[model samples]
Target: MEKAIFAMIASAVVGVFVYPKFIEFLESKGSKQEVNEFAPDAFKEKKKTVTFGGAVFVAVPIIVMVILNGFTLNRDLFLLIMVYGSYALIGFVDDYKIVTEGKNDGISAKTKMAAQLGLSVVFYAVYILTGGDNMLSIPFLKTPINLGIFYLPLVMFMLSGASNAVNLTDGMDGLAGGTSLIAFIPFAYYAYKVGNFGVLLFILAIIGGLIAFLFFNRKPARIFMGDVGSLALGAALAAVAIVLGKEVILVVVAGVFVFETLCVIIQKISWKLRKKRIFRFTPIHYSFTLNGWDEADVVNMFYGIGLVCMVIGFVLLSLS
Candidate 1:
């Protein structure tokens, strides 16, 4: 408990203290964000903001953990950081391309997906090799249900799917970071209950870093987390779920992310299948802005929705 508390505060302090300097550095380099062509016009002005601020908060936990724990990680901690850091690396590359090329399309979709999938394979192998369970904890079941051979694909999907889910949700100020901060609450609780201190500490550290990041990332933002932060956070959540056998609960907690991704997918399918659209904007959050809602209202509403989902996730965990 002491270690966890220390980790959380330490990470938060590091991120809060480092962000202004980091943002200035990125601005000095003139590394501004790239607004997607499909994004809301209001967001086009976001192009003036510095990008890749994720590198600070995303690296905070790992750096703090190493300073305290001494460059050491058990299998579960290894898997957690490995997945988180590697996904961040991928996002770093993607962000690099976007910033340098001066466009929202960063690296080819095929290339990005390939990197995510390839890293999933490596993480899966580590899990299996480390004697992690091949079983999944099904809600309302007293015993875990074994996945056997199917676990591999499921794990791969959760990793990459979640990575993309959070990525898709990062379309606005404080949207992704705020929702993800709420989403990790249940995982942190359950991790403590299950005695997964390593996973628990990592989650708390993330939550802390997010709390500080959201301070700057809020409306009229000073910095954006960019792909590096979003991708890493999603993968980190999924990896913790895998470690704690809380995958099902993760879905409930990350409901906002799932919903956002579905909005995008549905928008795409609807557009292709019919000459129509369901919402004025795809992410559905931006669509809220279309209906006389401002960015702060949308973010606050989603934060409320995320809290509700967090409560529901706890209810589901109680069933187990």
Candidate 2:
């Protein structure tokens, strides 16, 4: 745990300096924000800020983890980072194509989903082959459920679902990153309790890097994590929880994300079926903004909810 703290601090200190340069590098590459056409007008000012800041933060944690481990990779550590890095590649391609081509979206939705599921298959193979458990832990169930063959589908859904939930939540500054940082706290405890220090180290490293990223990511953000950050972060969270066998708690800890994703689904369904809308906006958080809530207020409010969710998740994990 002390080592994890060191990794976190190291990642944060390094990220603080490297991030500014990274933003500068993005600027040099002409990687500026290209707001979606339907996005609110307030987002116009963000056009000058750089996107893909996720690359820097993610790199910090990975590099720190490697160095701390004396550059060795155990099976669990390898799979953990494999999940993180691979999804990041998908997001990197997405962000790069979108920025370079000057498009609102880089890959088609179908293409992105395919990429996610495809990588998920690879991860599932590695996980099961490495003797990972197939038992699913529920918060209240006295017995753990064995998914066995069906765990594959769980892998696919958790990976894609978690990543996109964060992506949807990324509509505001400090929203996704801040909430995600809080979300990882309980997982860190679970990893340690389960004697999976590698995963704990990974989580701590991320927590530390996120601390630095959030400084720049706050309201009037200096940079955005873009798909690269959000997708990778979400995928990593799902992967971590899966490996820790705390899948049920992960959903509760990151409930804000699930809640937001549900809002999107409900909104779409209501619109398509009834020729009407549900919330004033999708993702639900944006509805408050449209109703005259300040962006910072909405972000803070979500952060508070995320904290409460994290506490609930921790308690549930303890009981389970």
Candidate 3:
């Protein structure tokens, strides 16, 4: 418990102090965001914001976890780090392409999905070998649903979907970071309750870093997490749920991300079937924004929804 607390504080401190310098360093190197051409006009305004700030927050937590865990190589932590790192690499590649090549087309969608699946397969293999179960814990149910052969695909979907969902939710300032930061709190509690100190420590570290990132990530942002931060965060967030055997709780805790993804899917489906777009832009947050809500208002509303779900999830976990 003490270690978990320390991990959170240490990483938060790192995020608070390191982010400004990191932003300056990236800015010096001409590392900045390039707007997606398909993005709404409002998004184009963020084109010059320094990006890939996810690098510092993501990397700091992992480092803090290692130090707090006494440098011991726990199998679960290793798997978590590997899965998280792989997604970060994918996001980094995209961010790098955008920064260096000066284009929004980073890695192709096909290539990115392939890489995500490959990493998910590796994670599944390691998890099973490490005696991980094939059971999926459904919220509010005491009995676990065993997936058998279908488990692998589920893992693939969770990992891939999480990464993409977060990426999609990154269109607004602090939307992704703030939502994720709030979501992690309950999960960290779950980990602590289950005596999984390693998971708890890792989450606390992430929470700390995210808190600091949110400082600059709020309205009128000085930095953007880009696909790099969002992808890595989404993967890590999903990975933690999987590790804790609370996959269903993830849906509730990360309700905003799920809602955002559903909006995109629904919008696409609606366009194909009905020949009309459901929202002015995909992802519900932007729809709200385009509907005349202030960006900060949209973000705050989503945060409220996220908080409610987090509370609901924590209660369910507690009852279970």
Candidate 4:
């Protein structure tokens, strides 16, 4: 608990102090967000804002962890940092391309998927080799069900899905990062309960970093996290879920992310099958935007829903 509080305080302090400089640096470097052509009018106002500020949050935590906790070379800790850093790098490249080239289509979907797949495979192999379970824990059930060798594909799916889910949820200011901090609270507690201090410390650091980011990430944002922050956070969440044998509960706890992704999938399927669109826009948040809801309203409502899901996750965890 003390460690978690310290991590959070340190991260928030670093974020608060560093954010202004980071924004200045991005502007000086001519890094700005590209507004999608089809995006709502509200987004147009955010066009010139510097993005990928998530790097501040990501960097502060890792640097603090290494300096304060020291490197243990534990496989789980090593893999978590590696995967998180790798995804962040990919996101940074994507954001950089968009900012520099003035293209919203930063990287090819194929290339991104290939990179994600490679990372997922490595993560799964390392996990299994280190004697991690292939069985998944059912959310409301006490028993763990084995997936045999199918665990490889499952892990890939979880990682890819989580990354995209978080990416899709990044539409609003502080929406993704704020909700993620809330979601991580329980996971951090669970890690501590399980005596996984390394994972606990890592999570606490992330939570702290995000809290600091939120200072700038709030509505009418000064900077956006972009895909770089979103993807790394998603990967980190998946990795933690797998480590704690709580992947199944993730769907429920991260219901907002699931709903966002499902909305997109449904929109795509409906477009193909019926030549009709369901929501005014996919990801649901944009639907709220299309319906004339203010960005703050949408953010608050989504966060409320996230809090509810988190409470339910706590209940589920207790039952388990």
Alpha-carbon lDDT of model 3 = 0.87
Least well predicted 10-residue stretch by lDDT in candidate 4: 33-42
The parts of candidate 2 lying over 4 Å away from their true place are 35-38
**Tens-digit lDDT string for candidate 4 (1-320):** 67656877898898899999999898898888755433667676665778888798889988877766655546667778878888888888888888888868888888888888889998998898887879989865667899988988989998888987898888887899988887887787788777887788788889888988888889768888987899899988888888888988888788889988898899999999999998888777888877888888999998998999899888877776
Residue 80 C-alpha lDDT in model 2:
87
Q: Could you estimate the TM-score for every candidate?
A: 0.97, 0.97, 0.97, 0.96
**Model 2 TM:** 0.97
lDDT of 1 by residue, 43-71 (tens): 77664788797787789988887677777
Candidate 4: deviation at residue 273, Å?
0.6
Model 3 clash pairs are: none
User: After best superposition, candidate 2 residue 173: deviation in angstroms?
Assistant: 0.9
lDDT of 3 by residue, 56-125 (tens): 8889988988888888858778888887778999999989988898878888999999999999998999
lDDT of each: 0.86, 0.88, 0.87, 0.83
Residue pairs clashing, model 4: none
Residue 38 of model 1 has an lDDT of 58
Could you tell which candidate, 1 or 2, scores higher by lDDT? 2
Off by over 4 Å in 4: 36-38
lDDT of 4: 0.83
Residue ranges of candidate 3 with Cα displaced over 4 Å: 35-38
